[model samples]
Target: MTSGSGVWITLEGGDGSGKTTQSDLLADWLTEAGRTVVRTREPGGSEVGQLIRDIVLHHRGDIAPRAEALLYAADRAHHVATVVRPALARGEVVLQDRYLDSSVAYQGAGRVLDGDEIRNLSLWAAEGALPDLTVLLDLDPESARVRLDAADKPFDRLEAEKTEFHARVRDSYLALAEAEPERFLVLDASASPEAIAAQIRDRVATLVG
Candidate 1:
């Protein structure tokens, strides 16, 4: 059973940064600690989000950056309303694989959108439901590319973007962490999964203390 006051946590990173593995490990740790947890991912949590995700990620046709951003925002709005908020209200610890930071990093930084505009759109979509904590898995772009190359599926639109775009996204995430030191935890992606999970556990324990 879950409590009625959940903690929201988000995991963020570029493709091949191992965010999925880290998020899963952290969720397992929380469950072992007797906490109810909901592990979800952006752009595909809700039914609507899944449809939009297919379009955004797999569509071969070119889409404008702003349009892409808007679709991401729309998926987020549905995710929060139907999934995240409900779980949080029930006090289930929410460990999301990615959230608004993905939009800001991939859309704003990677696409060169106006930062202020992206921020405004995000604020509106999220309705101030910011994560209680955000984990940023920092990795070298080159290393990330290698990992992606070995992945099961072919790259999507955002993942297919050039290395320079990924560099921008990484820089933007780092900058975001700097701006919100209290809520952001920067982890070394080069670390083993166990080591990264340990770091996440330490932070969550401190927060829950």
Candidate 2:
């Protein structure tokens, strides 16, 4: 559970899987329902984290897998300490775009590191803070690629990785969900935005009220 008396929800998925769209809709719905919502994303959620994010996501050259993982952990430590915990303490719903799960999926399974080690490191960074709910937008790698290409945006470091890397990430996410069924809500990313948002809202309703 999170550090305070508020809901902490995380949205997770491969890139271009509609997490931002769903997050926006969820934030709007929660705010309309008279809840104090704090919208944040890990790896760039704080000032220090922004710098770390630049290295991990946009650096022109390669970063060692362990070094990359450490950067993410550092950002997680600062972001949670400065941004997430404070919002939770204020009784605000934290609608975050990503969390430690991203590290376990991308750096762990995708990079062939020990998933358990990555998860343990992330837990240490956040002091074992876990989300009240994790909404996983599940999508195939090819579909995600098509979506990304359609957006016509420059690929970030992680996004520019090979399709096989993304496939591993998707599998790892599903495995994590399977291991922690109660904390996860897995939804097909192929669903229409409105439909996905509706499912998310239904699940969130049970958590928030």
Candidate 3:
């Protein structure tokens, strides 16, 4: 919202929480409204991010927790500079899959690091830029696991984590939303996709115009 007529919206939730489905639906709706929408995701949004993503998500080994956090921060710095900021300046609606909130939940809370430290690192990495609106699709880890199992895709590092880890991540996400209710729209991801998307659209409508 600060750069131009552009509005930056990020989606957050556990894996398999219907973020992609909702993003697709929301992007289609925004496109119908004659808005240029940029659909991207953290850890793979840019070329550099893709490589880092592979390392962090797929590499076979343990990356020190701090190192993992720094990798995400690096990706954030590049992504915001190369992808997010320019698009905002061009007045495009940026629909992102994840952002610093993921780092806070996954890296900080899940990894048992200081949530504030992870958040500060991300803010520093992105040069203090934050999304205008963040939509949090809340779902239980067990439900999320069922959805992921139904997908039959290989799990990423975080997705492969235990249910308890994911529960912590969910708690962190909820806490983040509670702390900044004005910037976040928290929804029950267990709802029908159509219902969830409608809610997202209603909130997004306020930001678009």
Candidate 4:
């Protein structure tokens, strides 16, 4: 259960882990349950964040790992202040896709940077805000690749990285969940979307009840 009046739930996973689909399902279910749901995503939730998202995800060039980490932190700082905090202040359930965890997993572990530094930077940027519940959709790199390929869409900067990079990201996510079991609900991403969503709903119900 959330300590605050508003419940903040984050959905985290590697690329093609079905986070977007599951987020949609959870949002719809919460809405049907008569909750005020504010569904959003990092690096694109606010107008300022959209520009940062493009630079970090779609830009064609070599970005220094540290620069990339800072860019994400910039987006996160603005996003939480303008979007997430306000929603939570209004007592609305904020269902977010990705958050500081993504930065820790991608930039820290995948990019081989200092994980603690990356996490500290993100936490400082977000003013120490942390999600009440983090639902991690765990999947293998190969299965994630298959799902990404099935989408028939071009890969983004992170998605285009080598298999080893994604594997590292997954390892980091699992490690984070293990370190914070009470705050995390780690689910198998290979499961059907309905099943995944059902499990998420059950956990969220406890928070919003």
Candidate 5:
């Protein structure tokens, strides 16, 4: 948990699980409730992070799994130091779309790297910062793929991975939530956006109050 005057909330899940949509709604809800909300995401939250995002997510060639993991850790280090930590110090609610969980799920599980090592790398990079709450938008890979297809956009490197890869990622996320149930609100991502948002708001209300 963060030792600051603010609340830090992170959303985790597989691709096309509506994390972005729910993140937007939660930010709006928090802002309307008179909280100073700082909405951000990993891999691109900072200017330097954006360059790393392009290399890791959109670059045309195969990137070594270890190299990809390091890039994400680098971005995470800078993002937390430059954006997240400062906002929390100011007593703001930081609604982040992803965090260490992404690295663990993608590079660790999907890329078949060691999840513990990946998590430790990120934890060290971020100086051991952890969110107060993590909302896991759990969804089946098949449904996620269908949603991605409907978007009609080019898939990034991770998004273009096989169904088995996504299944592993989902499983890893569930394991993580189970390991830290006190800090996680695991919800079915297949539900209506409004319904999901409502549940998230309820969870956040307790923290913010």
Candidate 6:
């Protein structure tokens, strides 16, 4: 809203791809370099968003694909209205852990919804908003599953899906990056945390130059 003053940077990846960890590191580096930074995550960056997030992430029963996608979109609209847009208006760099890309990957590709449908939903939900730069953390499906297993937590319904679903999500992400090369940075996530963090730093330096 404040005329090219703030940046929206979104981090995208499969579960266990270290998006949470890397997002934090990137925020810290940005703050250290004297940028006003806001760190937040999807499905729950606002009060309403959090409520919707719980329904989407932890619901014990089966939710239809379209139903699930709408819930996610609702959460994202709330998040953008309350959290993301405000920070950007104040000239703060918004470092989001996930954004519309998740919807396209999980709901569109993974759930067998048409990609165009998801894209339209994204545009509607986001009100034409998008990240200035999206960093996709690429990792093999097996490696990601191993990392998720190491997390030692009960897997959610979505997380508990077959490996094929996750593979589709990964492929969708790759396609997204290929389609929007100028706005996306694909990083190899199957690396040491520190190394991944370093990769993020170098990218920020180039993009924010």
Highest lDDT among the candidates is held by which one?
3
lDDT of 5 by residue, 46-77 (tens): 89999999999999999999999999999999
- True-structure lDDT of candidate 1: 0.88
In the order shown, the candidates' Cα RMSDs to the true structure are: 2.1, 0.9, 0.7, 1.4, 0.9, 1.3
- The lDDT of each candidate is 0.88, 0.95, 0.96, 0.94, 0.94, 0.89
Residue 7 alpha-carbon offset, candidate 1, angstroms? 0.6
lDDT of 5: 0.94
Inter-residue clash pairs, candidate 1? 3-91, 6-91
TM-score of each: 0.95, 0.98, 0.99, 0.97, 0.98, 0.96
Ten residues in a row with the worst lDDT in model 4? 1-10
Question: What would the TM-score be for candidate 5 when compared with the true structure?
Answer: 0.98
Q: Is candidate 2 or candidate 3 better by TM-score?
A: 3
Model 2 TM: 0.98
lDDT of 3 by residue, 1-209 (tens): 36488999999999999999999999999999999999999999999999999999999999999999999999999999999999999999999999999999999999999999999999999999999999999999999999999999899899999999999999999999999999999999999999999999999999896
User: What C-alpha lDDT, on a 0 to 100 scale, does residue 177 get in candidate 1?
Assistant: 92
Off by over 4 Å in 6: 1-4
| 1-209: candidate 4 lDDT, tens digit per residue | 22448989999999999999999999899899899999889989999999999999999999999999999999999999999988888889999999999999999999999999999999999989999999999999999999999999999999999999999999999999999999999999999999998899899889899
Task: Write the number of the candidate with greater lDDT, choosing between 1 and 5.
Answer: 5
Model 3 lDDT on a 0 to 1 scale: 0.96
Residue-wise lDDT of candidate 6 within 1-209, one digit each (tens)? 34757888999999889998998888889988899898888888888888888898899998999999999888887888889888888888999988999899999999999988988898798798988889999998899999999999999777898999999999999999999999899989988989989977887887566
Count of residue pairs whose backbone atoms collide, per candidate: 2, 0, 0, 0, 0, 0
Candidate 4 global CA lDDT score: 0.94
